[model samples]
Every structure is written in structure tokens, then in C-alpha cells.
Target: MNYMDEHILSLKNKLNYDVASNNVNTSLSQTVISEQDHSVSEKNLALRLGDELIPLELRVILDGEIEVSVPKSFSLMPLEQAKFKYPSEHRPEVIYTSEDGTVNITFNRTESTLANEELPEFVEQMADVLRSVQPIRNWLGTQVIVNHSGLSIGLIRFIAAGVDKNLYNEILLFTHAGQVMMGTFNCMESDMEAWLPVAENTVHSLHAVSLPLQSSLEKGADSL
Candidate 1:
């Protein structure tokens, strides 16, 4: 089966939503509760991804364990530690990749405390770690503070190109619910024009949501 088909099947099993498959187009549709009301609305369609609105049909399974939009052309997979190595305690939670593997979005999370450090300090430390892996050729840093859908987030954006002239990376760091989250977008330098907007939108979509009680407990246990 194709990656798209496999992703849809995984969503079906995970979310139990109404999904229809067709050779030409596959779609997922569901009625969700509006934030303003306790009543369910049929037209309350589309999932909110940061400031962007993604059609329901294009959304993959998003629950509390991890939340992010899955664009039609991308497939979501669990991070395999054996495949990628990083020096920090922060680890990749999930990854979204295009069919050709030329583009990738990685979601990572790490724990932090007020007593240990602040956001700016954490960003600098993380930046050093990233630079250590691959020397950065050019870098730009910015801060994003947004409050939307009752969620307020402060993020640090790092735009860097590595020594390899062919690749570019955009990494965002933020803290939510006592955990630091990083969203990294990497793509060919040639494809930046077409993929950068998508990557930014995905990064802005990060928010704090409750994971399944059992899943939360299991993660806590593993950390012990």
C-alpha cells in the first residue's frame, strides 16, 4: 500500500472517525463540538492549526499524545531513535515526511523547570547543540508570541542554512505545560519557496492538549 493509504488506515484505527476511500480522493468527515457551545454542530468542520484552517479531509489522527496537522502529501510516522541521533535529552516524538523524503517536519519535546532555566537561555543552549551537529552557514532568530483559540504560546524561530548549500532548516522552540517543544523543518534549498509556508504553518499549530490518561502514565513510568 502507498504511504497515504497506510496513513489513512492508521488514522482509522486510532481515531475511529468516519472515513471514505476512493481511487481518486479519500476523505475524513466528523462533527465536532464548537468551543462556544456544548452542542455539536455539523458545520463545525475543519481543524484549527495555529492560525490556519485545515480541511477535515486533510487531517490525520490528532489526539492528546501529539497534535499536528497532516497535509495531504505528507505521511506521519513515529520517530525511530536508532535512525537519528541528537546530543540533548530532547528527543523526537513524531515526524512528517513527503513522499520523496526531500522535506521533513520533526516534533520533539523535553522537560524543563523554572528553577533550571528560562526560555531564552534554553533557546541559546538548543541552538548550540544544533550547530554542533552541522555547522550553520547563516542564521536568523525571531520571537513569536501568539494567543489563539484560548492558547497562548511564546516561540523562538531559528532560520539557518547548513554548510551544505543544498539544504535549509527552520527550527522553532517553545515551552508548553512544563515541556519544551521543538518543531524543525528541513528541505532542499531548491524547494524552500514551495515548502516553507507549509512548514511555518505546521510549527505555529503546536499547542498543549491532554494526552490519554494511560498514555501519560506510561510516559511518566518510562522516564522514571
Candidate 2:
């Protein structure tokens, strides 16, 4: 089966979502993680999220990991990882399905930086489970949290909103390396809004997001 088909199946089995083959299609990985330790030139490519064309730069590490970095200005949305060949030692990309159906894809390459031929059976199963959610709509918003360590490190938690005409933008959180926590979406109109309900001070090294007055109205309008 193709990557899209396999991913759908995996999602159905894992998340209990009855996704059909026609409902899901394989798309490119939104974020690519390359390792700087490797001896490969940087590759520049364009990434499409909904309708936006994002400029992507990938640096391949000697061991087999791909270093990924996106522009600070553009909002990062959830994406599906496509099939590609790389060194074998590299850990296959991963996807997480939240209780509310938010999909998070993680390309774990802390180990070696090699891309193996085709994805292993295990990784394929994980992808299927991850994409089972109904795609995010223009008016909807989702809170995303990312954890990273090692040579490259960062923790990002932000509210992603398809604010205008499917144009998504992300409010910055404590987007730094090491351990970090932050919150962004606090409005009532979001499609599936939830928060990390812990003490604010305990978020010692946390990123805090402000709910501007204008943003409140925008969110309200999007919901309508």
C-alpha cells in the first residue's frame, strides 16, 4: 500500500477512527529534521500548508538526520509525513493523536541521521493512527506542544489558528530549547481548545501568550 493508505489504516487501528482510503491522501512532511553533524549541503524546498507556500531549508547530518527550521514569521500547522528514502539508522518520523483528535508529527532523529529505504512496518502503523482526525478547518484552532533535546533543542507550545481564509498563524510560546512549557489558546470559540491546567509559577521556564483584545474578536468571527 502507498504511504497515504498505510497511514490511514494505522490511524484507524490506533485511534479507532474509521478513515477510508479516499478520505486520506499522502502529503509531504511539514517539518524536516536534519542533523548539522552530517556532511551534506543544505537543501531549500517549498512546503505547502493548506494554501501557503513555506520556504524550507534542510541540512543533512553525516550520521543521517535532517535538520529542520521554519521561518519565524509563518505559522506552523499540523502536517502529514510523506515517504522518502534516507539512511537506515535514523528513527522514523512519528505522529501523535490527541484525545480530541489533534495530530502531531515528530521526526525523531536524535540517534543516527540516516533515512532507510521505505518506512518500517511499525512507523507506517503509527502514521495511520495519527491522521485519523478530521482535518483542521479555516476557523478552527489547535494548541501544539513540541519537546526537543540533544545537539538541536527547543520546546514550542502555541495556538495555531486559521485566522483568515485558511491562512494560519501561530502565537509564540516559550519557543526555546531544553525543558519549557507555555499556553496560547484561551478563547471559547476554538474548535477543540484545551490548556495545560497547571500552576503558572510552576511553569518556571515557561512561555506565556497574551490574549489581545483584537484576537478575541477575530476568534469569535472565525467561529461564526
Best by TM-score: 1
- Model 2: residues with Cα > 4 Å off, grouped in runs: 1-65, 72-106, 110-120, 128-224
Residue by residue across 21-45, what tens digits does model 1's lDDT show?
0011112222211223211112233
Global CA lDDT computed for model 2:
0.27
Write the residue-wise lDDT of candidate 2 on 1-224 in tens digits: 34435433433332222211112322122322223322112223333345664443332221332333322222333344222211222323332222222222223312112122222332333333333342433322322233232221222222222223121212212222221111222221232222121111112212223357898999999999
Query: What are the models' TM-scores?
Result: 0.53, 0.20
| lDDT by candidate, in order shown | 0.44, 0.27
TM-score (C-alpha) between model 2 and the true structure = 0.20
Error of 2 at 109 (Å): 4.0
